[model samples]
Target: MNENQKLALVTGANKGIGRAAADQLAALGMTVLIGARDARRGEEAAAAVRAEGGDAYAIVLDVTDPATIEEAARWIEGSYGRLDVLINNAGITGSGRVSPAEAIDQIPSTVDLDMVRAVFETNVFGVIAVTNAMLPLLRRSPAPRIVNVSSGGGSLAIASDPDGPFTGLPTSAAYSPSKTALNALTVQYANELRKEGFLINAAAPGYVATDINNHSGFLTPAQGATVLVRLATLDADGPTAGFFSADGPVPW
Candidate 1:
């Protein structure tokens, strides 16, 4: 590996927006690692990128699995000695949770507790696990960055506004709150690392056609991945602790 080349890892990158971001980053000349819970799927995604002439590879990484997180960290240390970018893109919608193909009905009024746990396991807690594990490697980079893929549904400002785009969204005590927690995490990390020259921020990929939404979205995965890639590749003077979309800053 070239000493000047940057290394980026994207968890849950086997498909959808995660895969799109990984491929975009690789095209920009960074060595991108496709992190996934399933090894075979991860390898397939990486191979797809390689076939497209990008430097990419698969590494099994189930973000909710502590052992796998630790092992992934160790692998990075032994192989690259440092990490330039860490994108916590792995997340679950908890969609189709209660009723089949339901979103608005996953309300907080009487949502299932077990369902909430499962959502947080992957969305909120999983991000924490992966970010914490990769921090040491990130510290060693001359230019370190962390991008958390969030959603507009996680925006309280929008949710509370009667005229807001997300006003019709469900209470989503599970999936939505988990992402809200992630946005909070992004702020905390960005503030903590601000003085250390690190840029940590969150990106809200607009509703995109993906498995998470059962491909019901109108936007393509590539379109949704734009802001994520932007945040991941922010310049040294770019804003941190900010929530943004392709259109602009998202109301926190």
Candidate 2:
């Protein structure tokens, strides 16, 4: 690994959007670290990338596990010495979906309290944990970028609108709120890191077909990963502390 070669980390990259993001990053000539909770899945994904002629490797990374996060950081520090980009793509939808209609009331009122806690534990707190743990390594790079994978469901404008796509959608008090909090955190971190020349942004990869939704989405994983890869490889002068979609800025 030369000093000039960039290194990136993508969380929950065993498959779907996260895997797509890792593959794209590797295609862009970066050494991508595929973070997955299951070691075998991570290695398999990494092997697939290598078979496709991309530079990628696997790491055991359960976002909720602080020990695993620390271990990953130590491995990166020892092997690469610096981390140029980090895509926090790992997240969970939480429980409460029997059906779309039933999900509506279930999410806000009848949802299990433990489910909400678990959602926040992985989506919100886990991000903070990984970022803080890797900040030192990121600072070592000349140009560092952080792309937080958020969701359109978290957009206040859409969620609050009367005629919007998410207007009448189920009130995902747990998942939606966690993503919203992630967007807020992205802004705060970007603001603080701006003076240090780090570009940090939150992006919503429009509804994509993946296991998370039981393959009901209209878009593909590649479509969702496009915006993420773009943001992850942003130029030094690119926008920071902002929310964006495939087309452009998403309403906060």
Candidate 3:
């Protein structure tokens, strides 16, 4: 509430990795805004953070809803005056599975153009919309950070290499491509905002257990959110326009 208090916004934070990221950021003394499409879930997540003695608030933010995005920006502008961190964690798996054996041709070969478009609508365009809408407020902070939640499956270096880990993995025309675009967008935005001292980077949380994969992952949501939180709270010297994971830099 005070000018000195740092404010952060984490989208799709009703549960899973987003919620964990919000919790970690709040624990670090940030006034976190839990952005969820469902108002009830958002408030519940915020309450959970409060129970942990963290400063948090709920805001209805359906990434695909332009009206809600505008409303959220207005609310932050009026209430916080400035935003120190923006975590674009809202994402969908599109129409594919990440299993190792699932082949590229097995997926809906026709690749629902609509599904691909819809995936980009949320995973790609939504990020751009939300970031552009909040750029003004982000500029108000002396130190600003933007963390785009991306995935290893989006790594072109791995996808293109014959000997790479992901080379033999299944592919989806939707999800993977959308995330690749997201990584590129992250780089472009970070480059543009570098002079403003805004640390913008894309992070892959590794394969985490969540509904997206039917809980097939080895890691937990907490583990996934750790890298995200680290990027969210980076110092001025932290890397920008880069792609990373828990272990180290992920091929971009």
Candidate 4:
């Protein structure tokens, strides 16, 4: 890596919006690290980005595994010295999710506890592990940013009201609540680091058609990634401790 080049890492970058964010960040002249759980898929994605002339590489990073997160952080610090951006995009919607055409049976009343724990393991705790592991490297950068990829369904206000935009949405203690926790985590970190030239925020990618949703979404991965990429590369004057969607700020 060149001394003048910026470094960014996007978790779950082997596919979906994570891959799109990695590609977009690389296009903007950052040396993007694709953090994927599977080595083969990660390498393939990195190869694809290289074929497209982007400075991108894959690293095995399973967010749910603290060891992997720590190892990845150490690797980044050793390889590039600092991390300009960290996009926590690795997440799972839980095994209970199905197509929109079907009824969501995994409501809070009957949701499995193990499923919820599994969801939080990736969507919430995993983010905390990776962020904490990467903070040292992030602080080394002149300008650092953290973007937590959240979901619109995580909005408690929208989910609680019958007349709200997200009314009739599936009740998910596992997925939705995990994202809500992520949003809160974003604010807490922003408040702690904002004065130190770090900008931390949460971004909702709208309903992007990825494997998480079983392709029920209308937007493409690239389109969904725009807001996340935007947040990840925020200027000094950009807003922090906020939740945003492609359209605008999301109500918490």
lDDT of 2 at 124: 94
> Which stretches of model 1 miss by more than 4 angstroms?
96-101
TM-score of each: 0.96, 0.96, 0.95, 0.96
Give the TM-score comparing model 3 with the true structure, all chains together: 0.95
What is the C-alpha local distance difference test score of each model?
A: 0.88, 0.90, 0.89, 0.88
Order of all candidates by lDDT, from best down to worst? 2, 3, 1, 4
Worst 10 residues of 2 by lDDT: 96-105
User: Which residue pairs in model 4 clash with each other?
Assistant: none
Cα lDDT tens digits for candidate 3, 67-116: 99999999998887899999999998655455545535325476767878
Best model number under lDDT: 2
Name the runs in model 3 displaced over 4 angstroms: 96-108
Q: What is candidate 2's lDDT per residue for 153-174, written digit by digit as tens?
A: 7788988899987655577778
lDDT, candidate 1, at 106: 66
- Model 1 worst lDDT window (10 residues): 96-105
Candidate 2: Cα lDDT at 133: 92
lDDT of predicted model 4: 0.88
Residue 95 of model 2 has an lDDT of 59
